[model samples]
Target: MDLYIYNKALALQNVMDTYGSLRWVRRYTECGEFELHCPFTVDNIRLLAQDNIIRKKDSDEVGFIEYRNVKRDETDRENLIVKGKLGEGYLNRRIVWGREILNTTYELALRTLVDKNCINPTDTTRIINTLILGDIGNFTGNINFQVSYQNLLKVVEALCLEAELGNRIRFDKTLKKLKFEIFQGLDRTSSQTVNPQCIFSKEFDNILDQEYTDSIMDYRNVALVGGIGEDADRRLLTVGSGTGLERFEAFNDQKGISNMVDNVEMAEAEYSALLSSKGNETLAETKKVQTFENGVNLNSNLRYKVDFDLGDIVTCMSKKWGITIDSRINEIEEVYEESGKEVNIVFGKEMPRTIAQKIKLL
Candidate 1:
């Protein structure tokens, strides 16, 4: 078989052997969409066993260690086979294979760090920093250092802040803003003079100029909160309804009307109850029912007029009218026959062209 396929088969068997059953393993091989158990085939089982990928258990008789469903009191033989197949397929896919390799590389790095004593049980931050930067000089100490978990977290936070500051300095060139001047006198009697200038003064000035220009443009566009020419009181007045002085009084009247409606409803209900008590039985059966419907109303109209402007009169009398006219020569006809019209032309040169020819088809 292909080397890749063989390796995947072996990997699936190994997973099954490690977990004591293919069904229980978190990652295995599948066929269609990538699952965990597509590799354990009849022909490859013996080969996998020889490679120690699949382990055989001898309990009275030699048998493959299969996953058992404890709840069902049955062996998960089909799931085990399916998982092997899925795992094999996953190994075959190139992207999945690359991801697995990258994962293994990181795992190897972690393992090396642990073995070399660069990472301790408590110092997770130092471990991460060492792994990323490949510098463990600061982490060298006794493994049994009496440090609390919170202290280790603090160290991690401090290291992170240091890294962030270092990155900012590297990218922003903040350190370059600090200038150093060295002055020396050739003779004992000689003197030197030094003058200093602010490095960011020009940059700050440019920023302010741009901000002022932007503010002017914003004011010209429209008034908004925090923008130039914005009237805070006018904006507040126009916020809702825009009725100004009348809004407050109208709101109070509306509240009063609602209260009156509620009171009237209550009184009517109480009167009906009193009537029922007085043996007016038919009044108790009467009840009000309300229904509501939502809909949209649209209206369209077209109006035509003749214009008599001085410019139009001049253009009509002028030798070279100085106007280029667009002619839609085609006519729209609503053809009507004795048996009613079979077709109607609504728009430009209408022969009902294909969708590709329609400009507004979308």
Candidate 2:
């Protein structure tokens, strides 16, 4: 597989068609990443430095190198290991300026956040001239959310996941800018007859290897939100209202969430709704995770991208295990090595892999 290299400025650089091994991963709810191992050569070393960009032809996932290391085996063989996160992670570099309460379609809310902080902030010093919002999202659903002093990427991702949506920041080669967009996957499950269904089942000989996990260890469906004030007088709200054995409650402290927007004090009910919105978003991070991972046979009737792609909801069943899953294609991994190319698919959200994700579990 050929890989194109570019500077962070989008300038064309070296291309590395030969590599020891490569792991390119794409995700729906989070930024994608890539790990590349290549022969230790002067050109490779110069091309794989931090801040450089790597991309695969015809793929929307573009990543910036963040790490590079040289490895030497006992036999004195040397190779370079390079790793990076996708351009979407650029949001991680920014933070919400202050308290933000959005009560509009999530599509516009997400764009407004990026626009205010990165593209065209009221503070001219914060403007990223080359970054622009794109017209890529059309999901229609009102969301009342509040966030303050938090990482921009994490907030946007949480909202997207709760809304059953996805997002990306694609490099506009000709325009020389990064376009941030929100998107939702198509429904391709067998339950729907309108579109061609993409099913992967052991019975069909397409699922090569499979592991299924259903866990509630980190799941909580109810949230008791605490707002400004003290004791019983404090503004309190609950989201994901459930009761009895069905209730899985957690507490969300949103004292920083102000009842005022743009210097005007909002009505009590309106402020309560905003508090509940923030609580709901916190609860969303504790959703029950039912993830499926497996090797896929590309030669099977189901073709990658053509039949189904990342973010598409597809059905998966294992008659042997007596479990069936209808979930979004949350992740796709492409591996390139000397032997050949291989693809693996991950359905549904997997366990939290980063410190930020793990903290939410606590």
Which candidate tops lDDT?
Answer: 2
What lDDT tens digits, residue by residue, belong to model 1 across residues 243-308?
443332111011111112223543433322222221211111111111111110111111001111
Worst 10 residues of 1 by lDDT: 308-317
Top candidate on TM-score is 2
RMSD of each: 34.0, 4.2
Taking the tens digit of each residue's C-alpha lDDT, what string does model 2 give over 1-362?
78889887778898778888989888888888889998899999998878888888867568999989998977898989999888888888899998777889988999999999999878888787667888845689888877888999988888887787888878887787778888888899989998899887768977667677777788888899999999978888888867788888899888888888778998988888888777877777787777655566766788878899878988878888998878777777788889887776667753554311110000
The estimated TM-scores of all candidates read 0.14, 0.91
Full-model lDDT for every candidate? 0.19, 0.80
Measured by C-alpha RMSD in angstroms, how accurate is candidate 1?
Answer: 34.0
Prediction 2 global C-alpha lDDT: 0.80
Off by over 4 Å in 2: 209-212, 291-294, 319-322, 350-362
